[model samples]
Target: MKISELSRRTGVPVASIKYFLRQELLPAGRATAATLAEYGDEHVQRLRLIKALTALGGLSIAATRNVLAAIDQADSSEGALGAVSYALPVPVAAQSAAGDEEEAEADATAGAEVAELLAALDWQAPGTSPHVQGLTSALKELRRLDARYAPGELAAYARLAESVARLDLERAAGVDDPVALAERAVIVFAICAPVFELLRRLAQEDQVRRRAAGDGAEAASPR
Candidate 1:
């Protein structure tokens, strides 16, 4: 297929496709002429993946390149997953000055709490994982606000996380190609994260409405 055909089929603008080609986000098609090239199905797939990563996943060009490189180099499901995780941006708290002992203590406490939670859950991620560090940072803020979860509550959240992780791994295992698996992971996180949050909010609202109705009924019961 020609580049024009590739762009038309993928609904990606020709200029954007050219930009991707220049940036090496999408591999160059075969050179049939000085100005004409033939693209293949693989090129189409890669272009779509790039579009999803940048447009939906909100990754920058550099980040997308790193993610694609990781996917290309990954030899197994775990490796691909680790690459995706590393590529995904995680919010880290701003560090304090070197002499800020109080800030250092808070960070230490937060890291310890995160370690404890992960240990209790038996999750095997390395301490240096971006997700772990982000969670630790979040826990630090939660602690500062006196809103940290009790152990039991944290355990409940861990169980939910485990369930989601299991489903993700199960789906990823079906794709034999590491690159395709990484693409799937990118799409899943980009598209499903917001959907999951929406579902949770809807469920909470339903539960609250039910509880309010129950409370009203109980108060109306002539005791």
Candidate 2:
């Protein structure tokens, strides 16, 4: 697609898109004979992802860039978050149920999700135990506040929590005793996901109200 179309689709202006390109937040669309090139689905996906992260995710451009860079770096690495994986027990029954008929319904999908996330991110699995627990606490609070979120969303959140926990374990890999090691993924998740989620839902609510207001104006105005 052309820059104009990309702009229309993302609801971002062509000028802003160019800015991102200049900032390297986005990859160069294409090199053209005339001096500029065309864009494709990858650019489109990235633009949308950027919008969700910035507009909804509330991350600054620099932070978003860092996160994206991390994911890309992790994707290129071997696994288990590099040296951190050794801290984890090579991935275990940490998954609640794996091979049962009852379990095949993607019951423990969070592990896979977080694993994929780690592969994509260049983030470190911080070993902050209190931070991990705080995240878990926030999720519990979220479920209490809003019941509309699907189970899958909750599971995805859980996977992240687990990943953080594993990350804590990774940081402790140098310690020989699994019998006593501190963990902190839940705390990190608390600090990260919930407040962002609150923003996304509030944005959704405001968008709905704006549409309703516009409809009311339409109904009330001279036609």
Best by lDDT: 1
Per-prediction TM-score, please?
A: 0.90, 0.40
lDDT (Cα, tens digit) per residue for candidate 1, span 109-151: 9899888888888888898888888888888777777788986
Measured on C-alpha atoms, candidate 2 has an lDDT of 0.52
C-alpha lDDT of all candidate models, in order: 0.82, 0.52
Candidate 1 runs further than 4 Å off: 91-99, 215-223
Residue 143 lDDT in candidate 1: 79
lDDT of 2 by residue, 1-223 (tens): 7889999887989998998898787899777758668998778767765665456545677766764554344533333133222322121222333357644444333334444444455445443433333333343334334533463675565576567556544644553321111112222232334655687699678667867888655444554
Best by TM-score: 1
